[model samples]
Target: MTDTKAQTQAKSADAGHASAPKEHYDIVVAGGGYVGLSLALSIAQASDLKVLVVDPQPSERLRKDERASAIASAATKMLDRLGVWGEIGPASEPIRDMIVTDSKVSDPVRPIFLTFEGETAEGEPFAYMVPNGAMVGALSDAALKAGVDLIECDSVKDFAIEGGMTSVVLESGHSCTAKLLIAADGVRSRLRDLAGIPVVRMDYDQVGIVTTVEHERPHEGRAVEHFLPAGPFAILPLTGNRSSLVWNERTDDAKRMLDMDDFTFSLELERRFGKQLGELKELGPRKGFPLGMTLARRYIDPRFVLIGDAAHGIHPIAGQGLNLGFKDVAVLAEVLVDAARLGQDIGAFDVLERYQRWRRFDTVQMGITCDLLNRLFSNRSDILRHARDFGLGIVDRLPGLKRYFIEEAAGNRGDVPKLLRGDAL
Candidate 1:
């Protein structure tokens, strides 16, 4: 694909100027994040659809991110099918084991309540820990190579629908019309709102403190989730001797902690992290994101559709946040491509509804599941804690149940998309 800058410059001026020539695209994706990029690459597989990604952020900036995410097995397959996994796989670390515990930060004994050995007979690990930058870089490379046009340093300012075509106006003063518009602008998606889609939100009033830590001892790819009274604290293994931490806590507490001096924050982290990793040194940047679940009322509106966090945002309790977004990309890509192959309008209501019907149920279920789990485990009620612990122990002992969980975490048990199943769209 040609550089968007050259395309824009060749077209017209950026400021107050004469009417710019309208660029037409088959699919116009808003927000060039992972999900949007993945969707663009998938659609470009046909080499027929003219797709454009509108994002305010530059690729270089996205590739400089230091955060990490958990990539489920199914999601890995999706990337592989998209010809991106091979590029990013070397930087990813497979999750070989997981331990779940219910305890307080001050608890002297944090007994492991449940442990899962995450391995499949297919020799596929359940998940991988991937740096945010690595994944973004790989996806961008693949999207560009596959001929997906990316309008960088500009975003969808607003859009209008006339007939079957949706006209999108970019902040750069560029105008483009497409048969379909995918809103992947993230949790606070402006495109979703512009399309008049409403979301039902269940705020947890908690925040997830995310950062990386270099430990003295090797984690051996073992992950840990400690269900503290406030929320879940997950220590996910990374390559080398580092691990990414998602420490959840009350919103107020998290705010205060984030404001604390480095030494103070380290002391607090030590209390929750324990000495299992020998010694711990906080690395890179630390961030606190408010936790909640938000599900859009509809995934589609006429020629417009929502994907990724624009469609649904759930708690990261189970580390399914990014995986869910990838799942959206996989299914949306398959639906749009299938419709195109059949000579049907990809943005037609009937065509778009297929993706809605296929994904809404699954999205709702995951949202509620995360909500229930957070409520069930994040508390100090002894009776409730004991019951949940007993349940965890039971599940741990039952190999069949453990396998079920592993599959679920691997994202292989849902309405399987061909892309996620390692098949081309």
Candidate 2:
């Protein structure tokens, strides 16, 4: 016997319920770190797009991170436009000037090879050394306030592009769908691997020892980078009489130093840190991150894209890792927003390729530059050292070239995106 019309309608509803996702969004970003949250905040603020961010950790947990980054002027501009830089800026320390020194660990005096007035031509500091916790906290809170959905304590387990939308499965077995899927999971991105994206990577066999130190004298907003045979030992000024340290060393040497007693470690730190900051005392805990450069072979897939560390992870030699990620967020957000306005599919290959085209060269160029800098500086060859020092001296003597380098470090060079240029989308 044939079913009644009402019964057929009820069965159809049941089928729909079985196939429909628990939730749907215009974009679902995996890994709600700085890049993911910033992307969500940008898109949510600029348009009515529904955005969701999934991460394995809660916002509070993310804020407990002890790391600090050198936030470039261009990034701060974007953050200000997003309305969260106010919270972050107050907690940050501007780099009023920067000096680069090339010397050996045994060198009694580290002669400054290059000096830069950190402020851009507009009288803004080229960069700020901001605590990671403050930046993450501000971005996370702002993203939430901007109406972006957040899912913590779980992450995107896997995903598949289907019928113009990407279906996502979370580790908790929860499922959702979105027009576009983004992976900001990090350098060792699980989502990137799942998507079959290949990467070009270089392990420097060096580790960056990150920590903070309290100095007897104030840093006066000056940053110092001592290019030693081990690597670049950067003393980035923080608020008060403190400075953040990014010390690079050979893997074995870093292991030994990290295992040293407090007194012994202080001596080791001082040998390179010098007496300019007066006495130095270690602050909080020290973290060692392996140095490397990881660049995804491609930045886009069908309805999928990568941002931040998932797309490229460069050496901290130039302190531009986070800045590169910010560039990604800016370009991608602008591309997607413009496409949405033009009534084009935001996740279409061509539309996504626009972002890839705009960002790919910049990312690769920066990665190679960092790699070369690391190689040139992190070595024991006397000839190479002299050569690099001569180059640095030339850059120092040429004010125009030095200004260009400062602008490059500020991330205001090249084809600037609207968000990065501090303009609204």
Clashes of each: 0, 0
Quote the lDDT for 64 in model 1. Answer: 95
Q: Name the TM-score of candidate 2.
A: 0.94
Could you list the CA RMSD of all candidates, in the order they appear? Answer: 4.0, 8.4
| Candidate 2 clashing pairs, residues 3+ apart or interchain | none
Task: Count steric clashes of candidate 2.
Answer: 0
Candidate 2, residues 276-334: lDDT per residue as tens digits?
Answer: 87999999688899989899999999889999999999999899999999999999999
Candidate 2 CA-lDDT value: 0.90
lDDT, model 2, position 102:
90
For candidate 1, the TM-score is: 0.94
Off by over 4 Å in 1: 1-22
RMSD of 1: 4.0
The C-alpha stretches of model 2 lying farther than 4 A from their native spots are: 1-22
| Candidate 1: residue pairs that collide | none
Note the Cα lDDT for every prediction shown: 0.87, 0.90
